[model samples]
Target: MAAGQVDELRKRVNDDWERIVELLKQKIALGSVSSKGIAADHMKRSAQFVADELIKVGVDAKVVQSTNPDGSAGAWEVIGSKIVNEQAPTVLLYAHHDVQPVPDASQWDTDPFVGTEIDGRLYGRGSADDGGGIAIHSGALQALGDDLPVNIKVFIEGEEEMGSPSFIPFIESHREEFDSDVIIVADSGNWSADIPSLTTSLRGNTTLDVTVSVLGHPVHSGQFGGPILDANTLAAMLISSLYDEHGDVIVPGVASQEVVGGLQRDLDEASVRADAAVEPTYTMAGTGSLAERLWTKPSITVIGMDVHPVEGSFNVIANQTRIRLSMRTAPGQKPQEAQQALAKYLVENAPFGAKVEVTPLDNGMGWAMDPDAEATQDALQAMKEAFGVDPVNKGEGGSIPFIPELQRIFPQAQVLVTGPEDPKANAHSPNESISLSGLRNNVIAEALLLSKLGGE
Candidate 1:
């Protein structure tokens, strides 16, 4: 592909910006949220919608169902094309159809499910996080006139927000169908607004729940004040020990890496007070880059603490209490191993006379992409042509567990993680949105990238 051809594709993308946004908004309004029990129906419907769109673009699209199905539990698959090109390497374009559940409508300026436009953004539940990305890639293919120079496939998932439990199993069963030389994941954001970024790393995550039970029953506080055991108090102590006074994770065995410069958060004294909800933001006490602490260090957060509360002013000692903890592990450490470390710390470090039970709920491994791969270089060049700025290399704190799976499956495939959204895109937050300018520029970038790689 010559430079002139890439420039022409970029111009074509800019010309089709409005149509892309409309397609995105229409998809977001569908409200596809998949969970363990109620995933199949919504997934099937979402797949149908994608198939229809692909067919409209003159691509031969079909819903490839999963072999294992439990009596209409909702079959999941992709609506895609295999642009047979023996001259070019195969590539897979990926996205997710499912979204996170919406918040109460009263909390937003407009309906959370409705794609509302405000201040140059389209606000909705899945607008920026994923729905917008899906639209951009689909539109890129449409603008390319259905005669792609390489074999292309779009693999969208319904379980992305729900930890992708069925993702690997599905992939394993359909491995031959989804094979590609490059995997392009557009579900992430730029480092900040107006700055395109290629996400080079993503920290994995694991979830564990701890419960402390004592005395087997709620005892009278006044009558047994001297010897009565408090499950709530013991659970609190177990959680508090997860971090040292400096807020650094005290658990051993987890990995940590050096951080890159310019990525640390510098909070003023006032900002610290407001954020920590106290007088000061507790420092980690150790010196390293903030990205090291954020992306490459072990972090334990108490997601929920259950305790017997006073609604009618009860004076009883509670016998049972529990709390959920989410531990974020670095790229090299296994999520399962980290969860075990957390469980061991909670069990051995609990207070005396308290029985602690630590249970792991879920886990997934972290991912790190090669920064110097062909896909990364091509994406940078495409973004520079579209946005007129060199893209930055970035690391994300969140995990896209499937990236590691893709790497393991296709060791030769180059992976790229650049997308249209930015820091303030509000993905997974109330009134989530995507910027029009960013989306337009990303369409141009992705189109250029396809032209660059899918050339004869």
Candidate 2:
């Protein structure tokens, strides 16, 4: 509200730093790994944990789940609200309680479920991905006490890591509980530990499954290899066709362009390489500024394929093969259209007339923030005050599919994306972490933003 009140809010956040970190540690230990398949016990417990914290901050919180198209109750979610004034504008704070699956905990430097702090960073599976986000919301609410100037709704999703398959249904099932004028998505990252950022754009994604077939049955490689190439080789050729000599995508109808906006600050090459752990010798893909190549332009990656394991392989000519390609589409392009272009290319350019079958796996839309919106401007200014430096507009290469869905359902809502992650967060990786500074700053920024939205 007032300058003095803002200072008091930040001081309160700093005072509660240890309490917030401890809460995050407890959340990490819950290990609510979200996927299409898993026991619901862990997720249910995770939602309760979040509800307990929000209740302490005066939110009326509860655990919920909605039925899917199959008439089955889907993933668990936590929804809460604190209405100080009904007439005041409402703000919805969003984050996920579920962490990514840890198929191999041995790869982590510490126990994947045990939150560990080292060199001012908290390391754990979901600490950066979204546990940090929960901490920010809880800590900020705790600081605001009963002085909140606006109504607030807290949404902790249980299936965000699974592309939010149950998210839209969850919101639609309880429209009144989730509706808000401003939605703050704490699921992305800052530009750096010292530089706060508001995520402004995201590249959408689509996947395809290409099946190449040559013969009806497997044949001896030594006896029938010359007549036609094996299915794996033919599949490889089709995969290669998606790229050109310089690694730029050549898929027809897929656009490749760079971001031209006020917030696009060119990235420093060395820093990005270090943060992404990109080897110096790896050939840079595409032709454009590194930032655009990552945030706006199209890129194709062979994520998976069905092939015989070298350890248990037989010397035979495979008759059929299936390959999965993950294509990152440009921000403004339609993912379904991109999927179509990819399927067409694979089907028409089959190697040696090999029978090809293309399957559309999945698709998600991208987003570009409207910088002129009142709430968007508020978030940027709040971040500047919290971090003591002007906040930068950032673009994310990854797609949070649920984001566009939120816009589709609530076109009037202003969505502002910001979070506690920095480049080194390593979210979804073995050594995931979040900087304590980012966590604290994000808490302060969110609290300030809520105050401003309430017309403080």
Candidate 3:
């Protein structure tokens, strides 16, 4: 197909941009925060709105009960419509309707639940991270009307912010309904506002809790200071030792590999940090591209330390302490293997004679995509056609545990991650927002992808 054909479609998408944003805001206002996500009940309502919209656009939509987790009585709906074309491969366009918890409401300028637009940007919790992308895909489907030529399926989740714990099982139980030639996870964002990116890999995550008990009771620091071990200090020292001076995770058995396309990741890191409002910290010593350091390597962070501080002039020594360790593993790494390694590391590295216990909290697998697949190329070309610019190929530092599991089960399906989100989307932060321009571009791109795939 000639690029002009795609370009025309792109123009049509641009024409409908305002309407798209309106629909997007309407969707965002529904508030579908995941478990521990920003707006739990609101998220459910937003998802229902999305289901309703999909049906209006000629897509067959239905809600699927998340059968994986017991006692979590919620449903995730699957919206789909087949493009009647023989040549194109079936593609599944995916997004999550969930938003993170909007804590510290006082810090936000506008209501986090209300979709607000200012200076050409749409501000809302889910606007950029996912709601924007979902809007784009929905807009594309709407623009195509009944002219679609390939099968397209939309898998929107309400549990992504909560690690998508229920989604993997939902996919497993409903595998037959989701059979597709390609899968597009439009949950991530671009490396920068200026650079569109095709995410190729995502790190996996594991959480561990370490509890320490030194004595039976809190003793006066001045009276019993001589002989008792300080559980807090010991815990701090053990946690501190998890990283080396070079910032490398020194845990034994936690494997490391050089990431691919490292240069882009360095750029991404700088961009991500700037957008995330991070203060400059010492850079770690690592050899390889930023992608390797981010996607292909292991990262350990002390998530939390539960310890009584010496506040209010307290002169007592606390008897127990606990810490939360969050570990992100590279793609192709086993969560159990990493968990075991962490357990062993803590056991061996702990302070002598202290009662130490390590417990695994959550284990989610890593994901790696086949970057050389045809669907990937088709999507890339479609992006170029829509934006008139080559998109960046990169990987995310965080993990979407469900992606790898989906790939493992549907090895034949092509997985692609592209979306309208950006660093400022504040996916897990306060005052989350999405760009109207970016949303327009994404809608065109998805429509172009649909066109290109249909023509094939």
Candidate 4:
């Protein structure tokens, strides 16, 4: 593959940018929220949509069924392949079709299900987190056409947002279908919009639902307010115990490995504050470098709570309070160990003699890659060529769970984690978006990588 040929392919991808955006908009509108079973139908439709697009681009595509952990039906996994050179190494391209639920739609600038362009960015749920990823795969293939140098395998996951509970089993059940020499997980973000990034490590994750009960039934607050222990108060107290005064995780036995000389790109505190909409008076928490705290340290968060709204004004002692706890384990930490630590912490620290119950929801191990691997070097070069700038190397605080699963299944395969998201992309949050130019550049990079890997 000559440099001139790669340039030509990149130009073709740029020329087809509008079509790619349109295809992405169609996917975003499907509302394929995997956590909500009611959206299963739409998720299947989304998978089929991806298959159809791949077919249109001359790839053989199909939708495969997956079984959920609870023995219930799961979303469809779209598998597409194009074997241009049988002797070349196969590259598996991965992204998810399912998206996070729009909890409070009112927070979005535009309709959460509608892809709206504002200031050179596309705003909508899944726009950057993964919809842009799907577009990148399709656009890259379309740009290469039948002249693709690699044997390509496309795996658009169906339930990544739901922690990919069915992924391991699904992959195990059809090992041959997922066989590849290299895997590119397009579900991470860049260091900044101007600086492209290659994700070298991912945090592990585990989740549990905790409930505290102090009373069998609600009682009038006026009569019991002085002595009664409301479930809400007990829950809050137990949750508070998991954090120290400095906001660092105080959970016992969770591993925190030091990240020594992998990717030294520290997140800019001011940019993080601005992107998160933090007030100017707010102080950052935890000890150590921002990168260390974010990528190599354990963290706990209360993702959701089941409590009565203040607007209702019941004025009663609540009988029970339920909260969903998400714990992010640092690389080299096992998620099950973290889950056990969290469960033990919650049970032993129940406040005011309140009964506490903790149920483990999901667990996934974290993964770290050798930055000096041959495939990684090739990918770095490809990204540099595509973006016309040196790409930064970084570690993600968030867990992709399945990345480790893929590494386990294909120990010999090199996994390349890259994506179109940036800090300002706001993935899994309100007003999520992707920069149009960033998406285009990512497609070009991926195309160039495939070409380079095939040549190798």
- On TM-score, the candidate that comes out on top is 2
lDDT of 4 by residue, 60-164 (tens): 999988887788876689987888877889989999888999999999889999999999999999999799899989998899887788888888999888777
lDDT of 2: 0.87
Candidate 1 stretches greater than 4 Å from native: 1-3, 29-45, 67-72, 111-116, 213-229, 259-287, 312-320, 352-354, 454-456
Task: Using TM-score as the measure, name the better of candidate 2 and candidate 3.
Answer: 2
Candidate 3: where is the Cα deviation over 4 Å?
A: 34-45, 64-68, 83-88, 104-106, 111-114, 145-147, 162-165, 212-229, 268-291, 312-320, 353-355
Please, what are the lDDT tens digits per residue for candidate 1 over residues 1-456?
467776777777767766787778878877776653334666678777877776766557777665433334334666576676666778788887778886566777778778889988888888887887788787778667655667787787766787666677778776776788888888887755666777767888999888998877888988986676688887878777777776778787666664322343432445434634764545444345556666677777789988755776588888888889888888778898888888888888878768899888988788877655666778778788777777776777778888988888878888887666786676777778888888877877777778777753
Q: Candidate 3, residues 56-106: lDDT per residue as tens digits?
A: 777777655464466566555555655565456687888877767776877
Q: What TM-score does candidate 1 reach?
A: 0.84
Worst 10 residues of 2 by lDDT: 256-265
Worst 10 residues of 1 by lDDT: 259-268
Model 2 misplaced regions, further than 4 Å: 1-5, 35-39, 101-111, 214-231, 260-263, 271-280, 307-320, 351-353
What TM-score does candidate 4 get on C-alpha atoms?
0.81
Report residue 341 deviation for candidate 1 (angstroms).
2.2
Clashing pairs in 1: 40-74
In candidate 2, which residue pairs get closer than 3 Å at backbone N, Cα or C atoms, i.e. clash? none
Backbone N/Cα/C clashes per model: 1, 0, 13, 0
